[model samples]
Target: MKKVNFRNKDMAWDISALILYPPGFNEASQYPTIVSVHPFGSCKEQTSSATYGKALAEAGFVVIAYDASFQGESGGEPRYIEDPSQRVEDISRVIDYAVTLPYVDADRIAGIGICGGGGYIFSAALTEKRLKAVVGITPVNLGRLFREGFSQYNPVAALEAMAAQRTIEARGGEMQVNELLPATPQVATENGLTERDVFEATDYYKTPRGQQPGGATRMLFSHAQKTLSWDAFAYAETLMTQPVMAVVGQKIGAFGGYRDGHEIYGRSIASKDRQLVELEEWSHYDLYDKAQPVSAAMEQIVPFFNKHLS
Candidate 1:
């Protein structure tokens, strides 16, 4: 495990990155690489995607995980804004950086996106021909979530209000964006979501288990509205030509959201390589850490990448 920094696209934006490489890495040898994408508004540390990165690294691949632009240690002003297009571009930029490394096998690079990141990875994979195999873990399609609501999860009006606020921000940058998670005991029910949805989200942002001083949060109103318009699944039919693997937790309600979407992608596309794996007794957040099924998922991830990327 080594801490590293790489230059990103926007001026003054530098991405803080971590590289987990197998023992005996040397200029003489090139290894396969996996770039782990973190969830929306999350840094590399909070999501525990690093756990997957590290495990894959130890298993003989170079695992690179970094804070998304404008979040965590990554540089960007007016932080916590969510631009789906920019986030997807961040994945591409990270790949741009990864390919320059001498120890990395440029053709063998793969991606593992968790939570909202899962959707972003898919979005990028749709257009990024360089990415070989892609994995989506408990993906949250913000467009669908904001438009249709989840499992009778109603925040339609509240989300609309948020969108209106975003429009206001875009016209004139006056209002500071609201931090979605409240300080102390972090409330997730602000959007009229059920207690379970709120509590589950709070478990990650509030607890010492997943908390970071400046981790994931609500996007600025302008960015929020833009994300509402962006739909990654829309490109599923075109993107499914590449291998896509989706891992979900069967125990959680929101888990079904992406499962059905991925299935639709598989059905619509002509590719035979895409697959879906549901981990028994695991919930959405369980994949965020070193829980039982998460470790199992990690084990499966290496082989999947190996089979596809090699």
Candidate 2:
């Protein structure tokens, strides 16, 4: 593993990333590469990116896991804001940096993203043709989540509240933020977040298990406005012509269904090769770090990229 930094020209931020090289990697030879995007409000060191980076590197692919511009070690103002547009552009910027590396095979570059990062990767892949293949692990469509609520149960009130918050922020009120996870496991359970997936996510992201210094659970209120307008699957049918795969857990507790992943795959009508892999008995957060599910996900991921990028 090696740390690197690059300037995001479009966003004017310095992006920090870690590149993992396959064993016996030689700079003299070009190798297939994969860009692993981190989840929303997470950093390079978080579970998903790091896990996939190491696992994929061991499988003979150069994997680059990066911090989003405003979130982790990257440079950006009003920190911790989750802007979907900027997140999508970050993948392209990383690809820009990747193509310059001596050991990177430009033609074989692909992308993999977990959770919210998966949504951004799909959005990026819509127009970023350089990404020959894309993989999404238990992907969440942030736009849908923001506009329709996590459970898709009661979004009308949530949308109204978000709009009101946007108005307040636009009028010079202090920036409001919301916690992405419960403050404590006790609180999570008190709020009926006892489902295995939700409980595990709280444990992993909020507690010592997977917590990093910059990996906060709070995000700007304005994120709702941006996310509400952004659709991850916009123009996917025609624009997403690249081979794509969305690996979702069969029992995704947080979202309650695999509708988002299925929508992404189904909308990619122009993709000659597309797949939706559902892991039995796994939940949304299970794919984040649970050894068995992570390994199982990679089993599908490695071969998909290998076949497509070959």
Model 2, span 190-254: residue lDDT tens: 99989776687788887777889878877876655567668888999899999999988888575
What does candidate 1 score on TM?
A: 0.86
Best by TM-score: 2
In model 1, which range of ten residues has the least summed lDDT? 146-155
Q: Pick the candidate with the highest lDDT.
A: 2
TM-score for candidate 2, residues paired by index: 0.92
lDDT of each: 0.73, 0.85
Quantify how close model 2 is to the true structure by its C-alpha RMSD in Å: 2.1
Off by over 4 Å in 2: 150-173
Query: Could you give candidate 1's per-residue lDDT for residues 144-217 as a string of tens digits?
Result: 66555531355555567776776777788576566655554433455554454446666777778788765756
